[model samples]
Target: MDQEKVNILLVDDQPAKLLAYEVILKDLGENLVIASSGREALEVLLKTEIAVILVDVCMPELDGFELAAMIREHPRFQKTAMIFISAIQVSDIDRLRGYEMGAVDYVPVPVVPEVLRAKIKVFAELYRKTRELERLNHELEDRVRARTAELEASTAKLRESEQRRSMAIAAGKMGSWDWDWISGDWMWDEGQYRIFGVSPEDFEINPANVQARLHPDDVDQLRKAIAEFNKGTRAYETEFRIVRPDGEVRWCVGTAAATMDENGRVVRVSGVTVDITERKRAEERQNLLAREVDHRAKNALALAQSIVRLTRADEVKAYVNAVEGRINALARVHTILSLSSWQGAELSRLIDEELAPYSLGEQIKLAGPEVQLLPATAQTLALALHELFTNSAKYGALSTRAGRLAIDWQVDDELLTLSWEESGGPLVKTPQSRGFGTRSLLASIESQLGGQAQFDWRAEGLLCRLEVPLTRKTAAAAPGKFDTAGSAELQRASG
Candidate 1:
């Protein structure tokens, strides 16, 4: 449907005239629509809009004058030009009649082809000019629509920009500022006033007023940063504390960039400051927790090293087994402490874990108040309990079928006292000298836990008492005294 390109219609009864017209107008480079009768010409007009019409005057039934009159009756062809071509001579009256039927020009018989071509060319150029004007009008309308859309978008963008600034301040919980050093004026938004713990009316809007709010300890550092900025530093960034007017201290971070003048001097500084007090406090707490974990880990490793150094064994396998057992007792204490987030461990729990191998039915009795020991104390007490169980198993309570053991403890204020008694076995006697297990047990209770240990060996059985403070941070506080149980002995045992 290219309206810019159109066809020329030729109506004649003979096929020869139609062929001649096609050959003559081939050089015009326009399409030619041919029809043999008035009825066929009307059909062509219905299908296509043509630039001009050329009709033969003498036809079989419907002649050129009749067809031209019919074309004039339709309003769609009002602007189309019609020409008459006859094969014979015609009278002036017939020519006048043809002009009355809307004929623009009359072509005589055997007319010159050039004259016909010249007439058709004029009308074709008019058609092309009309179509070109229409295309130009459509293009102009499209451009106007695009420009209007762009203007609407710019208006919306300006409105959203204001809203975006407010949302940014609320989400980030930060504030912006612009300092015009030339005017000595400071700009503070709502967020900035909140960070400084001041109201808009209370702020003086001057550099000196801002300087007064800076913490005394950090004022010099901020001054140095400002001095560097004034000297043309590209970036300004620092962290400092601010003492608000309400007497509250807060951590803040400042970042800014200075705008320079043509004279190479700082003219304005635009920046933001964020309140970071909560973040700083969280970081401090994390550091403290990490240090505490490191200290405890080191202490546990040192205690293992001490066990390896102090244990006396003849074979490598025996030494490893003994050390592994002692370390396992300490690990059990740690596990109990972990259940309470390392706050403390229950004394009864530690004792039960260490004596799990010994079935406590008739021969063993355990009685104690519910007492929670500190982490270090629990670890040391576990190993000491292990040594006590080993001693009773080998020579004291469990050596005979009828032997029995009784353990009981009581707490009074800061003091925790424990007693262990063995009976129903051979007559009790003290060793000639202290062995590795005996010395380790005494050192663990007295040196590590700041506790006192006393052993009494009677002829019938053995009795021991242990008294430790409820809260002893370190062994260096005070050493507990150990009393010797000087009695008879058949074996030099190490308990």
Candidate 2:
């Protein structure tokens, strides 16, 4: 049964009869509202939600039958149960009329309260159960939708991972092969045969023939790798040079794992082989390029020094200093580019490297979000920092041991502000004339970066600020990018 109280409406024309019914049904534990007339009862029903209605049939004007007919005509009250109560003896025709007016049952005057209470309890329980079932159904539908969405996301991730793996294998020119130790059977993929430079008809499919193809210098290494695999300490991985029939020497990487039987005896070995010939060639080419770059860099520095010497004069010292500073700035940019395979440099890394030599033990504060810079932006920034560092080392806070520098930057909308401040130096004064370094710094910021630069020669120390448009694509692809493996190989070859 529903724990909530049921609301009932009692309608009668006699006040004495209404009082008597209220006293009788007081122990029913339901909410009861009494109305004196059918018109008043209908008005109450329209304003409130009545679960059941008890009406008097023998009244004047709109009696119980007319009120019941009105309720039945309205679609809102179609489910409300009606009971007709009267003292008159109802014939078959009257009973039929009451039934046609949507009466559930007829109760005579002096009704039995227990019978009405029991019937209303049954309907209340049904309503409660129906509501509970509807709530559970809604929750079940929500859970199903959530689970289906999770399944779809998982499937999409799996498909993307598989596609990436397939692309990697194809791009790297790698293929898998298997060998049975007990049966002495060998199976090779097309890529493996292609890497070995052997036709299917010519392949001997034997261990001895495979060993003969490996370079003599790599035989010991190959044996060591196979020994490790047999001992179960690690998988087999060996790189060796193979001499093809067409007089080409190519490098290949082979990896395999041993499969053991139930008793731990070696049963088979399966792995993949990748052709690394192109990668090796690219490494060699990079080495040559690095050497060429180093030679040209030295030549360029020597040429700048020559210009400085030829133009040397007491009045031209500022010009010479500026030229040397710019040359050094170019060299620093080259160093950073070479380290990143000429891709780009991180702005924070560039700043730290430029200021490290001067701020050895002191606390050097940097405040900004980490940002990357393009090669052109890096060059311009490096030159500007070089000028600032040179000026500090010569005449600013960096000239003393008890000095500190703070570098900070911020980005707002399309503009970036970079500021440098120093303190704890000898009492400073404004310079009488701007030096070559200062003019060069200002010109570089304005012309190269399309920005403004300001210098404040305060009594405490020098302060420089720059405002620039931060419009360049920070993460765009560079022209000459090298992968990690290729860069490592090139470094080794160059060394």
User: lDDT by residue for model 2 over 229-310, one digit each (tens)?
Assistant: 6776436777878877787888888888889888777788898888898988999999988896776565445534543443
Positional deviation of 319 in candidate 2, in angstroms? 27
Candidate lDDT values, in order: 0.79, 0.71
Q: Model 2 clash pairs? A: none
Backbone clashes in model 1, listed as residue pairs: none
Which candidate should be chosen as best, given TM-score against the real structure?
1
Off by over 4 Å in 1: 1-177, 184-213, 243-253, 272-294, 301-328, 331-342, 356-371, 398-467, 472-495
- lDDT agreement of model 1 with the native: 0.79
The residue-by-residue lDDT of candidate 1 on 375-416, one tens digit each, is: 767777777777777667767776777888888999998788
- Looking at candidate 1, what is the lDDT of residue 124? 81
**Model 1 residue 108 distance off true place after TM-score fit, in angstroms:** 18
